[model samples]
Target: MTEQQQEETTADQLFATIGEQADNESYDENKVVNEIESLCMNCEENGTTKLLLTVIPFFKEVILMSFECPHCGLKNSEIQSAGQIQEKACRYKLRVNSKTDMDRQIVKSEYCVSKFPELDLEIPAQRGQLTTVEGLLGNVLEDIAIGQDVRQTEQPEAYQRIQDFIEKGKKMIEGDAFPFTIIVDDISGNSWIEPKPADAQNVWSRVEYLRSPAQNARLNLGNPEAPNVDDIQPDEVHTFPASCPSCARPCDTHMKLVDIPHFKEVIIMSTACDDCGYKSNEVKTGGQIPPKGRKITLKVDDADDLALDILKSESCALTVPELALDLHPGTLGGRFTTIEGLLAQVYDELYGRVYSGNNDSREPEENKKWETFLGNLTLAREGKKDFTLILDDPLAGSYLQNPYAPDDNPNMTSEEYERTEEQNEDWGLNDMVTSGYEEDETPAVIEAPDFPAGAPAA
Candidate 1:
């Protein structure tokens, strides 16, 4: 059949008239009609339709698969995979009238269309990566030792190098929680962490402890830690002035991202999509690395960052981009402040969040719910005593330092302990299943798995 064979009259709706694109690019024609004719007299009424494929995102990889729709898209994508490890036959969801002997298990979530199995090939590949730590250290090492063998290494030049590495802290990991080192090398081979931040604040260690479920990471995307290294809160759909940066359209596409690091500070990252091959400054930030070179750098959000936002927003019961732009920084030395002062400001921020979420007087269950939120028995006990705060916002440690507030709940009474126990139990169960001792294990996490087919099925 030729590409444009028409069995039925043109649809009532036309893309040319509707104005989505300049032309009709839909899969509309007789090949589909012919296929439908083989199955039933009706074609369009009971035939193929478009569907979104199930997405499996892992560390540095994305697998797209499709689900079958028996002439209509329903009861499809209903067969959820709860992180299953013990693979077995699953029943075909929408099998039509067939003989009892015709096996349906083989039909479940069609892994490949026999006619087009070459499309979704899972070809193997690999990529080399250098971590942020390695990159920064490598640069410093070259700068320091570029001509070291030519002459005797000088003294004050050596001291100056240390100062530069320590103070500049180009992309230091500041965890904002516990004591951690920020070891950085200067123009010389020496490396030392900013020790005062260790005594005064905690940035690196807390960040080191940040472990994520890597369920939706991509392959060869560099270290999984890249996300934390360039940490920004998840993307949030925010409204911008409905004017284009280039064409000045009344309705432009602008989106918002929070906590993108500016020079020694963090700020909101926003952008607009174009309508007419539009013109505007095409980059987000100009070489974040301090230099004479001035080309702007661009960073796009990934699927995992999107997932991170969903988890964080739900866990905190807080809207993503959780820390608003300049919420407390203005009161904390206008943006840049001493470590202690910054900590104070962050504490006040947490206090404000707690105060806003407070509804203790409503009911006992409400009190229990609040207790559940803190995930700390000592904090809950302190809440029972009467929650008080210093001011608008302060850093985490400062809030933890309240004289009247309960100290850290490092004991069994806390929900942290209870949660740990539950997790341990789950881990053991998972181990048992992996060992094949248990026939069917409870897959703890469940999400819709990918569909059976993709445009390019392999």
Candidate 2:
């Protein structure tokens, strides 16, 4: 029989024994425990007996019970030594196999906490989120509006604890509401939108960081510390707040690079409102970069004469490259340590776009000069970042909108999709078994024993 069947058999035995004992004598925890062990051990080894006994919880007399999965992880969150528990965690003693008195005491207490899910517990359900904002704190302008974070980047650990807290507080989820992001105004009038990969292929050698003290500082972080991979910047950057047409929400948009099934490489741009929960992700495929002969336009949206005037003005407009290199990079305001570091440094700080906010909204003509200087900007070159996008047109996304309204977003989500379409379809329709089904074959009609011809009717 299966595990479930074994559990059912064990439950039946326990109840029968309990009933028999009650009829003879009185309640006894020791006797009950002994009976449980005796009957449970003898139960069929199949899963049937093991899986069936949970129903005993509803019995008023069954105050305590124990179960052990043959194979399962222990002390799930982290490993702690007996020494540490003694010093720091009075309640977190280890589960040891010494069979000594101290070991038995520790195991008993720990098992009591673990088995009784209703009791107090200690574990950080959520850990290891980002530690810094870095060079990514700009005002995203989408469709001329601002944007914010509406949902907490879904960390399953956080929500699990949150569920525990809610359970303890006796709060009911009247409706589904999970907000994650925070939306804010474009106070700085600046923002960068781009894709951030959870893990990247490149790493800065120690020598590389030392070459440019300034660049090292940016990658290093707000507070100087030992350099690590986590310190590196992203490959692409974008400005936000025009409003993602799909979600109809506004905020600075950035993408966390994730693998798209079947597709080679693609970047997903997203903007989530902090207040009203709304978000949109625009997946831009890794397209072939135009050859060097391709004609690129710089849509300054300003007049040619005005560009000359600005150059001649007391404060000339800084080139996009200069703006990206010198003024950008780092977590917020550190410095660049190398001339050729990450692509973000090359674009946002050195060769980045710069606008006086007075340029014509249609200055695609001004790009002629930069286009000539850079030559046929062959985008598909090998050294270029893969599965990423480089969009300079600030006006390319004017019509984008947020898809959902506020109060609808979930706070956390699983990194992977839980159920596929096929599984969901099966949910509403269970096994096609018919209720109270009768055998289709006609029951054989037992011929009445032939009565003797001369037999009298009684």
Instruction: Report the C-alpha displacement of residue 363, candidate 1, in angstroms.
Output: 38
Write model 2 residue lDDT over 1-458, tens digit each, in one string: 86655765664454432345444346443243332221223332321111111111111112223333233311111111111111001111111111121111111112111211222322221211111111011111121121112212455566455455445323211212211111111111111111111101111000000112332243342343445334212355545455532223355667544343332234556667654455544444332321111111122222221111110110011122312211111111121121122233333322233221122322365445434322312221223222211121111111111123233213211122233333222221123234434664542222212111110000
Clash number for each model: 37, 85
C-alpha RMSD of each candidate structure in angstroms: 27.7, 34.4
Weakest lDDT window of 10 consecutive positions for candidate 2: 199-208
Model 2: lDDT of residue 133: 17
Give residue 158's error in model 1 in angstroms. Answer: 10
List, residue by residue over 297-347, the lDDT tens digit for candidate 1. 111122211111100110011110212111211122222222233333345
TM-scores of the models, in the order given:
0.18, 0.14
